[model samples]
Target chain A: MTRLAGRIGRFAWEIALPIVVLSYWWLATADGDNPFFPPASRVLEAFWSNWFDERFVSDFLPSMARLGASYLLAVGIGVGAGLLLRLWRPLGEIVEPLISFLRSIPSAALLPFAVLLFGIGTNMQVFLITFVCVWPILLNTMDGVADTDPTMLDTARAFRIGHRRRLTRVVLMAAAPRIASGMRVSLSVAVVVMLISEMFASTNGIGYVTIQAQRTFAFADMWSGILMLGLLGYLLNLLFVRAERLVLSWYYASKGR
Target chain B: MAPLLSVEGIGKIYGEGRSAYRAIDSVTFDVNESEIVTVVGPSGCGKTTLLKCISGLLPPTDGRSVLNGIPVTEPPEGLGIVFQDYSRSLYPWMSVAHNVAFPLAGKGIPRNEINDRVERTLAAVGLRGQQRKKPFQLSGGMQQRVAIARALAYQPKVLLMDEPFASVDAQTRAELEDTVVALRAEFNVTVLFITHDIDEAVYMADRIVVLTPPPTTVSEIVEVSLPFPRDQIGTKELAEFVKLRSHVYRAVKNRWDDRQPGQ
Candidate 1:
């Protein structure tokens, strides 16, 4: 019972500052006649009117779909390519300059190229998000794979484990902590790139709705979209952390951290 | 009837001319089936290099080692190695049972047989029923036992132990030494053990191979005629055990002194 009461107290303390800031915003804008700065109440009202209906299905679902597909694609390709490149030194060297060149250019800047090639479809949007997100996973995987404890490799080899099992079961798991760290970084990148891709090439997503609200000067609607973006980013990170905890449970347990 | 492992004139050199370093000049020995042999040398006498060469982990620049009638150019089948650094060698991601079973995955053994072998091997190392725990959860001594269990589960024709008990406390080290001796009787596996401890070499080996320091070569090989199931207290206190220990100790110390700059 004390533990439960303590948890409640902690939760209230965590929300205290946010609630105070919210109240201050309400008091400061009580007159609520500004075009640029909508009162928190008006923003909440617009959030309901804009998002709690058809736009939720037409706009929000599409944004989430694109984010989901591109993020999965990036993680899969990143891990596969990372393993192959690290395992084979020559192959990694041959593509070193090409990877550098691609990584150097902001993936958002390639939006024009993406649109020209795949044309503002879901394909173009996905290409941009995946391109941006994959770099972190791939680079971190390379470092981790390269730095696997040599004694572990020696032990596996001495035991006559097959090449395939050694690579997948031994090498991959050894590199997982670094790979997971990179993945966490990319999850945030996936969220940001999802918005950028939608703002540029998307015809029907939350990013599109937000941009549309801004263009027509629906200030309350735009504020609501911004709030939703923050909410969604926070939610996606929470989900990623949960997934990370599950996959790397042994890692944490072994370290007793 | 033939020797199970023959480390015949194996040698290793690091780098090329001008900056060259000769780590092992020529190391030669033989271990017959089910026999235990220990190699003891002063620190940095290429004891590790010699073991790596024989186990086929590192390529010897000169000569070759033959294991079970096959020339060991690479890590051969029918061999298991337990490195001294037990913590790093055992996969932390794996449970103790999984770590033991990992090498058997590609051996095409049936599931039931593999489980049985894993359990039996763990029991041999005195780690039975602790299979669900991770390696880090165990003490250093227990962790090395898990490593030993992992090796013994493979049922290798030969087991190469590279100073495996060097990191454990003295009491645990003594227990592990006896465990290996006892397991040899059970498993009938040929063993090539490496160590810097003279007492360990005398206690655990049927024969002791002492090495001279760098450009390292076998200085002497002394046979230990002590009886099996040797006790830590009784066997170590035996007159024959002390004489053999001193003989190997003098051989190792003599070479160590020869290599000293101001001696």
Candidate 2:
């Protein structure tokens, strides 16, 4: 019971600052509101009105779909290309300069190229998001694969482990901690790039709704849109951390960290 | 009927042309089936390079290694190796059981059979109930035991060990040596063990094969006629043991001194 009580006390302490800030916003904007700054209660009401309705199906779902598809695509291509490039030194050398050149240019700058090639649709947004996120995963995966202990490689070879099993079991397993860290960085990049892509091109999704609300005089709805995005980003990160914890349980246990 | 392994005129050279550096120069030896042979040498005297060549991990620049009358162009399925650095050689992500079972993963063996083999091997190494523990969580000796267990589990006809006990404390090293002695009797596997310590070579081997310094070749092969199940204290006390030890030591020193500066 004391442990439970202590946990609850800790939880309350965690939220104490947030609660104070929210209360200040609520009381200050209770009545006399500027045209730009809507009352906090009205923003909450707008959040429910805009997000709790069927409109959410049209706006929120598309954003999630784009984020999920592009993120999955980036992970697959990044890991595969990373492994391939690391395995073939001559090929990696030939392509390394071009990869570095491409990586240096911002994804937003390539928005025009994407618009010309894929047009201002879901594909364009996805292309941009994937482009933005792949670099971290690819670089980290290559580094990890290259850093696999030579002795372990020799052990696997000496044991007569097949080529495929050696790659998956020995090389991949050894590289996982670095890969996980890379993936974590890419997750945040995916979120940022998703917003950028949607705001730049698509007329649908959360970014579109937020932009649309801001363009009009609906300050409360705009604030609600921003709040919804913050919540979504938080939720995605929470889900990612949970999955990372499960995946890297062995890594953490072995490291005793 | 034939020797289990033959290292006939094997040599290794690094780089090309003027930069070419010979590591092992014509190392030739053979191990009879189920015999424990120790290769004792100075550090950087191509001990590891010779082992790697025999294991087919590295191709010899000069002749070749043969296993059971077959030329070894690749790591033979009938051979297993335990490296000195157990911390790097064993996978950290795997549990002790999984590490032991790894070599058998794709061998088309039944899961139950693999489990049985893993359990049996771990038990033989005195790590029966510690199967679920990770390698890093164990002591240096235990980790080496796990490496040994992994090799033993593979049921290799020939086991190659490169300074396996060099990384552990004296107590653990003694325990592991005893374990190997006991294990050999039960498993009946031919072992080619490498070490820098002459005492270790004498204590653990049936025959001590001494190698000279860089561009190394077998300088001498001193047979150990010491009795079986030799204790650390009793074995060292034996007049025969002392005489054999000195003989092997002098052979190694004589070769080393022959290559001294100005000579």
lDDT by residue for model 2 (A144-191), tens? 999999999999999999999999999988888888788888888888
For every model in order, the TM-score on chain A comes to 0.92, 0.93
* Model 1 spans with C-alpha error above 4 angstroms: A1-12
Model 1 Cα lDDT, one tens digit per residue, B1-263: 78989989998999998999999999888999988999999999888888899988999999899988899978988899999999999999999999999988867899999999999999988887899998999999999999899888888999999999999999999999999999999998888999999999999999988899999998988888998789999998999999998898889888889888999
Positional deviation of B181 in candidate 2, in angstroms?
Answer: 0.8
TM-score of each: 0.96, 0.95
Q: What is the TM-score (0 to 1) of candidate 2?
A: 0.95
True-contact fraction per candidate equals 0.93, 0.84
TM-score result, candidate 1: 0.96
